[model samples]
Target: MKEYIERVTDGEDLSLSEARTASSLVFEAATEAQIGALLSALRAKGETEAEIAGFAQGMRDAARTIDPDRRPLVDTCGTGGDGHDTINVSTTSAFVVAGAGVPVAKHGNYSVSSSS
Candidate 1:
């Protein structure tokens, strides 16, 4: 799971400051036993949209980035699904938005599991 997290954040070029902030969050959120249980529960039951959205908001609040003067910005994200049979419509949507003159920040991951 740590490896998965590292891969997901690879492009962020996380600084020592960022690492410290994440470490603080982890320390504050769970004891060792609770952390283990949380991971197990998520793996078993899958994460809810609210949980994922909350995490995204938390990361945005914690990290530093260009403000773009409060201009409209859009992010396109996909919740990976099972099976290789599905084509990436979400990935295509990002390009379509960019082609339509909207600024988009797209995020994606390589399929690592058969269920992804």
Candidate 2:
């Protein structure tokens, strides 16, 4: 949909030419029907560990331009899907560590199902 494309591309700081290239790539790769089917299948099956690992590796590669040496950094992330009803213990731990003068990068999604 046009609205979906607009929302995805708006204010992304990309050049016009770059945006056009990306749009072309998306359009050429998958039709709306194909996209819908792929999404449905992925949602039903869930992502495999290899798929997740590839995604994470891609993210790390994309961050190569960033200088990690600028700060003494540490990341605190928890595996396992906590239902978000546990009072955000990990977030609290991040704050405590930060308060104790350790730089922490905490990554978490909002809730398992939005209302949880």
Candidate 3:
């Protein structure tokens, strides 16, 4: 993690594997300060496509797979951390779509930045 932070802070882009390793450290063993440093470094250095994909892979690795029986599902997932302080419409939209006979799957996490 420190290596990643140093490299990114030095304006070096991480390769896919390096980004994946860094993300794994973030999710598994990184301290809060290390996480913050890495994020700050990445933000300052600007994220690359490989970095984004690698981080996404790391997230997938950490997440539980839920294979729904239904096929052709609609996912209405949001981060809820946009810092807009606006009302969330994802849940309502999911309900409306379901009412209209469309399959909708919504994420259940609460807003992280502002009240909805």
Candidate 4:
């Protein structure tokens, strides 16, 4: 974890393996503060595609999904870094789009910092 933090401090991007390892630590972390710092650091540096993929994969591996007997699925998403006191525009847009005969499975997260 310290090594990961150091690499971010030096303005270096994480490789796929590094991203996976660091993200896996998020679930096994002993404290919440460490998880916050890890995410903040990655967001501050602007996650690369490979890094994002690896991190997402790690989360996916940790999650359990059920195969529901439903129609085919369509998913759309966005990671919000919008300013304070604002609603999620992407989710709203998804609603509108889905209402117009499109399927949308939208997801969001909390983003407290990033605006300069």
Best by lDDT: 3
Task: Provide the lDDT at 26 for model 3.
Answer: 89
lDDT of 1 by residue, 1-116 (tens): 35323433343233344434433465566467554654454445555554455556556666556455655767877745555656666677888888988877777576443342
After superposing candidate 2 on the true structure, give the runs of residues whose Cα lies further than 4 Å from its correct spot: 1-72, 113-116
Lowest summed lDDT across 10 adjacent residues in model 1 is found at 7-16
What's the true lDDT of residue 55 in model 3? Answer: 92
Superposition error at 32 for model 3 (Å): 0.6
Q: Alpha carbon lDDT of residue 50, candidate 3?
A: 98
TM-score head-to-head 2 vs 3, winner: 3
In candidate 3, position 107 carries an lDDT of 79
Error of 2 at 84 (Å): 7.5
Clashing pairs in 1: none
Q: What overall lDDT, based on C-alpha atoms, would model 1 receive against the true structure?
A: 0.55
The TM-score leader among the candidates is 3
Q: Model 3 over residues 17-86: C-alpha lDDT tens digits?
A: 8898898998999999999999999998899999999999888788766558776677888656778876
- State each candidate's clash count: 0, 0, 0, 0
Question: Each prediction's TM-score against the native?
Answer: 0.35, 0.36, 0.64, 0.54
lDDT ranking from best candidate downward: 3, 4, 1, 2
Cα-based lDDT for every prediction: 0.55, 0.51, 0.85, 0.73
